[model samples]
Target: MSDIIVFGIDFTSAPSARKPIRVAAGVRQGAVTRLNGLMALPSLDAFSDWLAQPGPWVAGFDLPFGLPRELVEHLGWPTDYAALMAHYAALSRAEIRDLFAAFCDARPAGGKFAHRACDGPAGASPSMKWVNPPVAWMLHAGVPRLIAAGVHLASLLPGDESRVALEAYPGLLARELIARRSYKSDTKAAQTPERLIARKDIVDALEQGRTRLGLRLKLSHAQRDELVADASGDSLDAVLAMLQAAWAASRPRYGWPDAVDPLEGWIASA
Candidate 1:
């Protein structure tokens, strides 16, 4: 086993005791990636502390690290990505909603939300969307903490060398294995047997190294069952992120294209 700690973080806009941020911690060796541990950060403070922990580690976070270039340009926000993040972090959620809404209001129909370039290939939610996934708020909440943690944001922000953070979308990897089958939900009523089965299928595929990522997941029977039993699927999502982190560790620029938009960060392995 290598000393390089790899992580997959399933982030939330609002972390709380009821639905804490979920994380999967692992280490990769050759073609096998082993689950090292799992954690929950019930508050942003806890998550910030986790981000500040000493590393020799790299993490995959399931959140957009930047806004749409078009939106940023139209809003006349700072062109530099770090400056833009700082500007964005200063606003309240209400202000964010209002400004983004106004941007959409001025745009023509069917193009209400402007998206980052990587969003198209990753099938990700628009970073500007305040509803549904509320990823815009996620960017507001999560990105600033990353900035404060001083962790290097792979191709985007340069900070601590030992701790590298990459933007990851578990859906990008999950769909490669299971297509569009639903695997998880937050509501009790939406957590069906079919979803449970789908989660199991994903786990099985990872263990068998069936996906194009070429990294097999290593988990004890108890760990495997625990991942399968989490009806909310946060754990599974974390594991998916972990796999992506593992894939990115030794790659040049963490597998991102050389021409990634500095204003809009690229998703790892997309």
Candidate 2:
């Protein structure tokens, strides 16, 4: 009877029909129940619509929320969320590439950009950083939808207790299970039998409730097969994030407050 709905999002900016957003749902019993198979959402609009539906829900988004404080402050960008979103959205991908390249040009050869303290501890790349993954654009594309849907960010303490959003890093959970075994194969060519076995191992552990976080992943047989079959871990990543959100949801003290430093930002595990 817990009214909280849990969603785990596997996000992408250029998602297509074949690899749309993957979402997993869980409901609270004494422990969490993995209600059904993961759902594939076509776009942010569809995601927003789903979020706006009746019922209190908490979502674990697999994208970064804010940029590193150092980068934002150094670049003299607007710090407010609304202004930041506008500034971010207005820039084209090419512009972003150029700006980031220029920023790197100003730094020492080895050190390109300043990183937040949390980045090292949480093992997350800086949102504004463009090198390994363009996480900044990921934040740009993803956070607005959460805002539009009126979800409360766990990092930004909201007045409403019903709807909650938490920034979740799927890597943290994946590392716990596999210890750097490369369980998720993003490239289709890299998908192998061993990777599939790793996915199954992780899935089995979750279904059996084998984490210190105190929640069990409930999935139907078909759901289990789908999750294991996804060598890319897109679906599995969403499910991992969902569990992180569920763990945060169980702890009321972890609610996000408004004073978060946009530059330093916040990390889910940190």
Candidate 3:
């Protein structure tokens, strides 16, 4: 059996004890991926420690790994992926907001944000957006930790070969099963019956192997209940990400395409 554990991370830029980063852990055997556990990282330090653990694992992290190549060029940031990450990590959130806002101000209306190549196909937000999902902050928070932990980011950077991290987005997979249907929401008021039904539909589809990835999600009875009960959707997103990681593990280059821009790293299964 392969010793590689698969992990899916639902990341938060500023994790607290109340709103910690959520992770779904699992392992694959043949065509089925069995979810093993869920984790809540109380802080960035805990997340860092988890990544630094000694193991051979492939992780699908729900965080943007790179900015749009066009944005980087326009801002005169280093073209080198590693260097750009270094420069980015050094800035405060306020600085990032100011810089990005300035960039947007210069652009024409209706297209304020620069996007990575994979964004169009994945139907994802631009990595530069700081509000709503705050993916930009997620990138700021997550990438540096991956770098410090020495995890190889497929085409983006080579680090700890055993601990390979790929950019994963749960929406990319969820959309495949349920087109634009809202599933889970963080707010209690927004967790409608329709969203609950959507979550169940998504779970059912996964169990039926209804995705292009062709991997069945195996869950215990208790696990299924736990997944359906979480109105926040964090746990479900992690599982979705784990499925992506499992799929990537089965293919070469961690399932990254040949044309993926190294500077603008591609999302796994995008």
Candidate 4:
């Protein structure tokens, strides 16, 4: 497992200079995963290019790889996973928002957002949600590019085995350490000392091998400082994702669940 590049991507539905797609690149050697560096892809094109790169690399992307199976069934879309993605990729974002909003409107308040099987375990937002976290848009914006880039979408759409893409939620690991203390804010006004402390706690936990992933995060002092300093938490989220990738790569089945629902891709190590 040593020297295989592991990438963690904190993706954005709309990438730009202000909020570029953040990537944390590293490699796993035994139980310690070392941070190589970080980079930002400012456009979808750049992200696409990144995906097409030659790999013996495995990645955990902070985006939904599939929509809810219930939602797909309700819409009478393709039941097959690959076909469902294609049908989904053809729709406009506005079309998606409208459909999802209508679905919510017809359902009871508590039962509005239909979820994938992995959502509850991962503590992830619904893949069909178009507001707040807007992960539906993420699925739209990110997954198609992964498809066109010809990378394997582990369990959902197979491509290059060496270039694997796994769904990952940083919150899954963060909550393990900090218990839902908010550690990031896109708004500077909301980036409080409390959040900074929370970020530090997360970093410490990863460095100390406190999480259930069982792999320690190896960071230079400067790298540790860099992860903590970014109040937006994008960098740390990317690293957290990388940790998930590292955990998967260290194990059999790429750390995915046994018999994953093709319509609802599993989050690595969830």
Estimate every model's Cα lDDT from 0 to 1: 0.92, 0.74, 0.91, 0.91
Q: Which stretches of candidate 1 lie over 4 Å from their true place?
A: 1-3
Candidate ranking under lDDT, highest first, comes to 1, 4, 3, 2
TM-score computed on alpha carbons, candidate 2: 0.88
Candidate 1 per-residue lDDT over residues 16-105, each given as its tens digit: 999999999999988899998899999999999999889899899999999989999998999998889999999999998999999999
Worst 10 residues of 3 by lDDT: 1-10
lDDT of 4 by residue, 1-270 (tens): 356689999999999998999999999988889999999999999999889889899999999999888889998999998899899999998998898888999999799889889999989999998878989889999999999988888778889988989888999999999997999999989999999999999999999999999989999999999999999999999999999999987678787778788888898889
TM-score of each: 0.98, 0.88, 0.97, 0.98
Give every collision pair in model 1: none
| Winner by lDDT between candidate 3 and candidate 2 | 3
Global Cα lDDT for candidate 2: 0.74
Candidate 4: residue 84 lDDT (0-100): 90
lDDT of 1: 0.92
lDDT for each residue of candidate 2 in 81-157, tens digit (9 for 90 to 100): 65776687788878887877788899898788667666776677767666457677777677777776676665443
CA shift of 5, model 1, Å: 1.4
